[model samples]
Target: MTLDEQLKQLAIEAQCHLAKTPERQRSLSRLISIICQSNKLVRPFQGQFQGVYEEIYAEAQQRLFLYLCKEIDRYNPELEVMQWANFLMKKRFFIEASRDLLPTIPKGVDRSRIKRSPLEVLEKQTPIASQVNASLTEEIIQCIQEDHDRLFQTTHIEHKPAANFQYIALQFLAGYSWKEISEELDVKVVTLSSFYGRCLTKFAPKFKAYLSQ
Candidate 1:
């Protein structure tokens, strides 16, 4: 069977288990495990939170499991299970990250004496190290956004190549996979991967400088 057929089958089975009471817990847990195993959902969080990646990954997985159980009834069998699972995983990561960054007051301390996470403190300082890290993130984001915009605009380039660049930006900067872009654009996976590699090669120098900023 094709990948699409397999995903649809998994979705159907998951929906069936979700609707039934006796096998619900076991089946849902199995389905969640399968989804987690099939996708590298934590890759996007690694570069941004390198020091705390393990914590973030554990939190994201736990939250995703809970969320899938809570929203199982709303699962759409027509959609790919892994895709939806990855989407929820990314959402959970951001939610957990934000929660972690929130200032908290100690039991006996005043609200003004709230403690901040290391990330928050780092962002607030004006040291050279902090400035370089902040500048790198800002510049990379700006450069990617500019490239994304240019790809979408009318330019003196072939339509296919322009579209390929836009898809590459979406994959790298937007955390999409080649498979997802292929499905969306109705292009073959091999073609998209090849073009994406070319795009990366072309942008390697600029990206290197941004990372070193």
Candidate 2:
């Protein structure tokens, strides 16, 4: 049988075995192994990361296993299970690759070139908070919001950030951890962190001016 036909057969068998209490674990394990071993699933990332392909492939398999376990009940026999599995595996691969490939800021960069965290900047202004009028505080916040919107526009023109960059930044401003943002946004934590770094690089000067004012 062809790969698709083989996958359909496996899906049928897997569902049947899942329905049986005694065979469920064994069948699931076997099915996961079969899926992980497919050339089509593993070929995309093979030999791509130099010495880390094995590591990435292992992580991808682990992620795929978890996904399959969570989504087993929702599996539809009418659809191609292998295709779904391929997509999940590929996504996991890219996430792992992104984590491994995220660039680091160079040491000895000027402090002024680094953007201050919004929360940190806000905290530094606390001593002056009592002296400032309410309208002034509101205006400052409005100015910061405008700066964020402007960065969002400029970055789109320049770097074309992932679609969720704005939401990620808003969540960061609201004091969410990268882990929390990852879970809430269905994005990898590393990807969000990297994107945030890029945003800081581009927005540092404007943010620094805002903080100074």
**Candidate whose lDDT is highest:** 2
Candidate 2 ranges beyond 4 A from true positions: 16-20, 45-48, 96-213
Worst 10 residues of 2 by lDDT: 128-137
Quote each prediction's TM-score: 0.40, 0.39
Q: Each candidate: how many clashes? A: 0, 0
lDDT of 1 by residue, 101-179 (tens): 3334223323432345687455334232112120123355466667755643332124555455644544434434334
- Highest TM-score model number: 1
TM-score of candidate 1 to 2 decimals: 0.40
Q: How much is the lDDT of residue 179 in candidate 1?
A: 43
CA RMSD per model (angstroms): 18.4, 21.7
Model 1, poorest ten-residue lDDT window?
Answer: 127-136
Clashing pairs in 1: none
